[model samples]
Target: MSEWRIYRGVREPHDGIDRLPDPPPWRDFELSGEVTPFDRHADALGDRRLPRADAYKAEERTIEAVNTALYLRRPLLVTGDPGVGKSTLAYAVARELKLGAVLRWSINSKTALRDGLYQYDSLGRLEDAGVARELRGPTNGGPQVGERGDVVAEDVAAAPASEEAHSTDLGRYLRLGPLGTALAPYALPRVLLIDEIDKSDIDLPNDLLDVFEEGMFEIPELSRVADKQSEVRVRPADHGARITVVHGTVRCHTFPFVVLTSNGEREFPPAFLRRCVRLHLPAVDDDERLRTIVRAHLPTAAEDADEVISKFLSHAASGELATDQLLNAVYLVSRTARDGAPSLDRLTALVFQHLNVTVPTES
Candidate 1:
C-alpha cells in the first residue's frame, strides 16, 4: 500500500505552532533491540497519520491539546459524543508522530487488559501443528508401497506415528491483539488508542491505569525460559511472535503513543482522569459539520454535495438525525449518481428517508 498522505492544505493554518527542542543524540530508539538513544529522530516525532490541522472545527483547541500531550509526554483523554471524531484524534496524532503503527484497544464490557494486549489463538496454532505433522510424516515408503498397494497390514506396522502433537504453551503464541500489535517494537513510535473506555466495566479502566502508568507489561511468553537463558525472541510489530516473560516482568519496553477515548456516557474514577490530559469535544455546528463531510467523504465535490449537506444540516438543527446517518446518506447518494451528480429531489428523498423526518406539506 502507498504510504499515508498528509494534506498540506490542512496544515497551513497552524504554521506557527512552536515545536519542541530537538532531543539529544543519546536518546535514539531501537525497537527490535536496545540501541543508543539519539536526537536525530527527534524531528520526526509527532508525525501522525492524520494532519494536525484536518480537525478544522476545533483547530486551535485540538492542536493545543495535542502539543501539550506531546510536550508533557502524557496520555490524552478525548471525551465527546459518538461520530464527533473523538477517536479520530488518535489517528491524527499517529499521523503527526510519523509512527508506522498504532495500538488500538477497543474497550467494552467484556474487554480486559489481557484481551487488549495479547491473547494466544490456540485454534490457529493447533491447525498449524496438525498440518506440519501431516506434511512431515511418511512419504508413502510403507513396506515397499505394499506390493502395488495390496498388502497394507505390514505398511501400517512400519512406523507407529503419534497422533498427538507436542503441546505448545499455546498462549505463548499470543497474537498481540490491537493493543499488543501497537506495543510491538518498531523503528517509529506506535500510537495506542484505547477507544470507548466508558463501555468497559469499572475494573477494566482501573486495570489499564496500572499498565499505562508503568508503560509496559510482562509477556511471560517472551521471557527467558529457565533452560533457555541465552535464547530470547523479541517479535517486531511487523512480524508475529509471542513475548516470553523472564526475570522480573515484561514492562512497556517503549512508551507508546497512547490516546484513550470516551463518549462521556459514564464518569470515570477521579484517579483515572488524573493521569490523563482530558479534552472535551463540543458538538460541531452545521457549517463546520458540512465542511467536514465534504472534506472527508466527497473530496471530488459531487454535484449534490450542497443539497445533501443542507438537508443533513436541517435535520441536525431540528435534532432529528445523526451526523453519521447524514454523512452516510450523502455517501450513498454520491456513489449511486450515474454521473457523479445527483438531482435535488433524489437527495432530498434520501435525506428524509434516512433521517426519518417527514417533509412538510404545502396547504
Candidate 2:
C-alpha cells in the first residue's frame, strides 16, 4: 500500500549484540509508541557517567560553557591542544543524555558529502535488473497479465516492473553521514562528534554552514520516483532514505547537540565561527586528572588509579607527552586492572612501555 522504510527487526547478528547489557531504563520508555522525543535525550544529562566538574580540578568556566551550550541547543566549537579531551566532550554529552555517541569523522582531503552518507551500490542494482530479466523472460515462464479476458504481452511487461522499481535515488541510499544522521529527527537526542575539524579542508567548515543552518539535505536520485514523491516524507533514517531528493525543499532538525573539536591548527572563517558557540578547553590539573581516572576506572581502587594518573600527569606537565595521550594511557591501565588481567605492578611497566611516561625501576 503506502511506501514506508521498515526498520529491520532487532535481531542480534553478532556476539556483541547478544552480550549487550539490559537496555537502560530510557531505552524501555515509549512516548506514545511514536518513539521518544528529542528533549528526552537530554534528560539523562543529570546522571552522566563522568564525575561532576566540581569533583575535578578542571576549568569550571569550560564545564559551564559546555553545559550551557547543551541546554541552549547551540553548537559548541571547542579548541585546544591535541590529546586534551577536546573530543571527549561528545562522549560525555552522549553519556549524560543517555544517547549513544557517534564519533570522530576522521575527515581528510578527499572526504566528500557521500563519504558520510549511506553508500549507494550501483553494481548490486544492475545484478538485480539482470536477474529480473532472466526470471521473467518468455523461456522462463513469466507471469501472464490480461485485461478482463486476454493475456497481453505489454500488460505482462509492465506488471510492476521490479527491474525499473529499484531506486536510483543517490540521496535515498545515501546513509546519513555521522553529522547528518545525528541531526535527523529521531526519538533520541543525537550527539554528533565532528572530531578534528581543523584537519578538514578550508572549505569544509564553510560548506557545512548551510546544512547546519537548515538541518537537512534532499536527494533527488532517491526521491525522483513518482510513488515515493507523493507519499514518502523523505526523512533521513526513515524509509531507508539516508538522503532525500529535493523535489521541493529540505530542512534540518533544530537540536542535534552539534560538537566540533579543533586542535587550534587552523582558524575558521568568521561566518562559520558566528554560527557556533566557541570554547577553549584548558589544561586540567592533578586533582581533576585524578578524578577522571577514578571515575572511569573505579571499582579498581581510587588509590591505585590515582597513582598511575599522577605519574602520567607529571610527565605530561613536563611536555614529555600530550594530555590526551595521558588520558588514553589511564583508561587503558584502568581497563587492564578492572578486567583482572593485570596487577598495578605489571600495568605500570606496560604503561611506561606503551605511553611516553617513564617508570622508575625497582630499587
**Of the candidates shown, which would achieve the greatest TM-score relative to the real structure?**
1
Candidate 2 lDDT tens digits, 53-148: 112223455556655555455678999765556666665545533554343466776666555543444454444444655655544334233333
lDDT of predicted model 2: 0.51
Backbone clash total for model 1 is: 36
Query: Deviation in angstroms for 45 in model 1?
Result: 21
- Per-residue error at 140 for model 1, in Å? 31
Estimate the TM-score of every prediction.
0.64, 0.62
Residue 335 local lDDT, model 1:
70
Q: Where's the lowest-lDDT run of ten residues in candidate 1?
A: 1-10
